[model samples]
Target: MSSSSEEIRLAAGTAEVGVQPGNGCRLGSLTVDGVELLRQGERYGSFPMVPWCGRTRDGRFRNGGTLHQLPVNSPPHAIHGTARDAAWKTARQSPTEAVFTYDLTDPWPYPGRVTQVVELTEDALTLRMAIETYGDSFPAQAGWHPWFNRHLAGGDGGQDDSGVQLSFTPAWQEQRGDDHLPTGTRVAPTPAPWDDCFGMPGGVDVTLTWPGRLELNVASREEWVVVYDEPADAVCVEPQTGPPNGLNTLPRLVTPLEPLETSTTWTWRRL
Candidate 1:
């Protein structure tokens, strides 16, 4: 629950909100009056990254003839890029908006840093992260991982009793092994425990409704949304451009861009 006095605050009705954008990561924290809307104790995890989510196997990829090896910090693969848990230099800050930037040079596979801007309006919060690659040959993938609490509907107290209901448009599902990595594929129709990614139906907005009719809507400019549930008090409604381990599946599930080229905007707003 520790926050800076100078942190940006936004209000929707009586809600007090805060945003921090640094080191290619953008984060939002919301509270109603003095009670937390999101999970306050878990607020300080990671800035949610440059590549945004996980990478390929071993962080190894081939661009032309050179095989680049990134730091494997996330066990089986390099997760959330290099800047997820990194400290970002604050670029700008105000009462409702904050911007943070990170620059990567030297031997890192990707040659440029990214800038992330987080804005808080009365009803919603938006985070936009952009990476400007210095060279044209680098591969890039980006998305978001936001954890939402069901307690937000009942004022942070009914988190345990509150159940989460999610609706998406996925025709198929990928099966993963014990390592949490994809192995095979299956046609998923019945609801089950999901840590998988799926392609979105065009123009269809995914919604997660809690006990008190409070809903979180995730609309994407990309093709898919990854719905991950831990079956606890919270669930992750991630708006992503590709599947997990996308680096290995680049130019397929992953979106490829050039230097200074930007990806589509992934947005989420509360309802």
Candidate 2:
């Protein structure tokens, strides 16, 4: 399944990862020793959020009782999902690991299938995603988004005080309303240029320090994690599995033998 772009490199010892199985199964970069934890182009690395993961309010959604219109493409709201922009299908690769596949046709009326795997070890970097359905029961969400790199690469000179340093302990904050979605009320974790949506519920752990150069540790068993650092260069840790219209508030259904999975793991060191 070509179409155009194709890169899939994965190393282990010095830790490198760049998989783009034609863009939707994106990553593009995640170096380690040479230090570049993501963020390098085409809107920056790490991308996957199948079936629906962010925004869909003005774009509409309502599976069982009808009402489905989506295509706002972030106009008033309809961001992220649609498999990053389609075109994925490698199904398997080697070196350090890879796998991509997509098949949820036409403006997305259901009849799903999405899989994305990425694995690089020796310091860790793992991502897995899944959503399956072929009949009935279908409402979904899955996540990943990662756009790290605020000045990675042995910092101390990249400025902005050497950039990257984000901690996480969220158990609240999701109150965003005013069209940016997420007003189910639950506030309290402020301080940053934060775009909002947090409620780790003990899942999605984050850390990304880069003071002496690297720290990275962004786990995720998924419980919603969207930390958009207001972008001065990059910082987007988005674990997501709901929160942002959440397909009309939080719907996760995907039946047809239970198929909805999520995973995120990015371990690191060297600081």
Candidate 3:
């Protein structure tokens, strides 16, 4: 359960990003001018999601004619895939960029490889991920789950929707059922407490601004992103290849020749 604390730090202007290669290739911290932007801890920062983005119904999925049952990490559902907590091998590294890779084995049913590349610039950070199977084609998804602090400058450390403002024009929302899985019905965007998925047919683009502080623009070419802001201390704007339970509902098959790739970028500036 312990990962190498060794960090690969990158800095550009007032922005600093820390990546832990051994710890699931997780981003430990993202600070802008000494102000921490990501929540700190096991469930914080940002982690890559591969094979699947969110959750699977009852931890079970029927691919082709075989029924695959994943371990129920979240009680009734299998969440976030196995990559988030898995240790990734550092394939390459530089002063401001790194590449991490993980091979998918048992339980997953498909033999595949997942690769994540992170690049840092003076004003932005870009993340790219892809999955490719060695054998037959299989369903998969890719995304990043970043838990951003509500108060960028370490205000009270309380979990309230204060200071930070979230804005996005979603084309539609996937109505969530009691199981926290999408009900296959798409509705219009509503208010807060949105642990739901939204469709950005135009592309995944969202804005987070802490008035008088800094403004962050999260843009991705992916068409789907989940915005979870019901928490007190932080908010999550997840950009994924598909919605939760998509493995069974909307599977994106990846073959040895065709890999599923997606990218997301976070650009920031002082406001």
Specify the highest-TM-score model's number: 3
Q: TM-score of model 3 relative to the true fold?
A: 0.95
Give lDDT per model, in order.
0.57, 0.82, 0.87
| TM-score of each prediction | 0.78, 0.36, 0.95
lDDT of 3 at 171: 96
Q: Please give the distance, in angstroms, between residue 207's alpha carbon in candidate 3 and its true position after superposition.
A: 0.1
Please, what are the lDDT tens digits per residue for candidate 2 over residues 1-271?
7454778888989998878767787887888776677888875788887788778788888988998888898888788888778778887789999888899887888887888889889898888888898888878788878888787643444444678889888889888978888778898888989888898877889898888767888888777898898877888988877887888878889999999888888898876
Backbone clash pairs for candidate 1 read 23-88
What is the per-residue lDDT of model 1 for residues 62-87, given as tens digits with 9 covering 90 to 100?
A: 66677877777777677666665555
**Candidate 3 Cα outliers beyond 4 Å, as residue runs:** 1-3, 154-162
Residue 108, candidate 2: C-alpha displacement in angstroms: 17
Error (Å) of candidate 1 at residue 43 is 6.8
**Which of candidates 1 and 2 reaches a greater TM-score?**
1
What is the alpha-carbon lDDT of model 2 when measured against the actual structure?
A: 0.82
